[model samples]
Target: MSSAGHLYLHTPFCGSRCGYCAFTVEVGVLDRRDAYTDALLAELAVEGERMGTLRTIYVGGGTPSLMGPERIARLLDALRPRCADDVEISMEANPETVDERSLAAYREAGITRVSLGVQSFQAGMLRVLDRQAGPEQAVAAVDAARGAGFESISVDLMFGVPGQTDELLDADLARALEMGVDHISWYELEIKPRTALERAGAALPDEDWAADAYERIVGSLEGAGYRWYETANFARPGHECRHSLGYWSADDYVGLGVGAVSTVNGRRWRNHAGVDAYIGTLSSGVPPTRSVEHLDEPTRRRERWMLALRRDEPMDMRWAGPPDHPEALERLVEGGLIDVDADHIALTRRGRFVQNAILRQLMEYA
Candidate 1:
């Protein structure tokens, strides 16, 4: 029995790929979109027959906005029965692809939240990232989406690019606030392997510099009335992404489509990475899973601690257990990576900067 409450659908097509992105995305002929949607729905049906009702569904993509209304409607139609009432449906969009009609169609199809990829307000920065949207187009997309009755809109911003200055970043932040989005995901630019940035030898700012930029970003958004709920994501009081919160909180989720990873119950599985392989597998009326791992009890407990540490909330000390290295937690406590209370251990604001180190310490100790 699947019985998962979270659903994630990955739409893998983009008009063009971003420079710093390494996700399993494809830029292909528009003619292939309909077939892609059909295959996605087929995957969803197979998963739904097992997973039952989902309380939240996130439709993320290379650019979901590029899909037409009918395609989106058809996909959602397949998803409707598997979803519970008050399902927090979310979709990631490209500012260049969303229009009034598309926004309306998404709202009508039960997408409650729209996250626009507006990496930077500066046209130069956008070009550096190979982004297709201009400042005007970004503004227009937000206006159109709000006009289409999407109350909870989110925008993504990037920092620490090759030539991004603090002044330019401040301008971008101000522009984002002026756009009136309820949520803002301010991400530092990281050059991952195989991405355009990595190939172009794009130099990322130093870790200290990135951390400083993040601090300033937090200050600016909070000053503008957004709450810093997670490390990269911020929102107005109740507008925090329920789906993402579920991710960091170690809740169960079902991920569908090529290259998607799902964690249901205690088992982790990933679908086939190649689109062709995924489609061929689905054509045989079988789930296109590529690999599966049933995590051991120790692995699960360790993962729970690591996942909980991502949140602003304290980690449960019960899971902390006896450290593999007796002095690890004590050293982190002294170094200020984490703080211990009566029943929980939590990262300090400074600790969040070097979260990987703290988690490594815990895992190494384990």
Candidate 2:
């Protein structure tokens, strides 16, 4: 047993798929919720032994809130005994899928944190992304989460969407700050292959404009007393997402449910993505089919550097192993792209904006 302390659970049901989403998800599957919950618990019974004293558990999804509080409570009750005393259990939610009553039930069910998917507070942007929630619903969700007394409440926002204007971005930012949530994940929009946005030939803002937008987002959030803790994540002091920090720090984790991926003791695997297959196999007392990959030392080393550099903290080179191009350090340092002291190296403020380019120069792949 690897005794991995981090865990992730995926719930794949969604009312509808977003235009820019490429995640494994099933729409119009509300009737299968009970079966799916049973499958998750069945799978966890076998996988639970692989975990030891979990420090964090993130329930992510197509819309985890759609699972309803009763199902969530059942799942958490099963996992509770395995969790550490101060474990952080987080879940992702869609704004329109939650209400004050439901959020209160979720909190009572042992979910300490809630991350609402409020991609944009602008109605036009929401329509462009095919999000069912409007700006008012987003606000209502946040308010409801707060009223529910969750330990931390976060929202997911986006930049670089088509037809986004400076005023629109400002309005979104203003609304987010006004909400006073504990954390925010503001990401640039990407047109993933096979997604509705990509199929429709949706284009993102130009690189220069996108870059400027990112800078503005960072500045605005930081100005509002939020720490730009990670490249795309901002948080108040002591509110950083522990589950995500586990991954960036190269810790092993177990993932459950259909389409979930896990890494433990240098081996990684992804469960098959079919909902019916997952449920059927688990119900039959068999683990779902999965594809496994064994990670090499060099591969893990490169991953360490890639994930660590995304944070504002220093990376311990000794733990990360040598970069492919160690000789590039002096040049990067002299160019003010990074700062190095003995075995610890960190990206400078200027370098973080062009982090991808810096990674390309330091590692085999960016």
Residues 1-366 of candidate 1 have per-residue lDDT tens digits of 547788888888888888889988887756777777777878876777557677888988767787766887888888887778888999999988889888998899889999999899899999999999998898998899999999899999899988888788889978988887999998888889999899999888777777788888988888888887787888998899999988877788988888898988788999877777777777777888679999877777777776777778787777545444546878889997889877788898889878888777767534
lDDT of 1: 0.83
**lDDT of each structure?**
0.83, 0.94
Number of clashing residue pairs in every model? 1, 0
Q: Return the top candidate by TM-score.
A: 2
Q: Give candidate 1 regions above 4 Å deviation.
A: 319-326, 334-336
Residue range with the least summed lDDT across 10 consecutive positions in model 2: 203-212
Return the TM-score for candidate 2, rounded to 2 decimals.
0.99
Clash pairs, model 1 backbone = 324-365
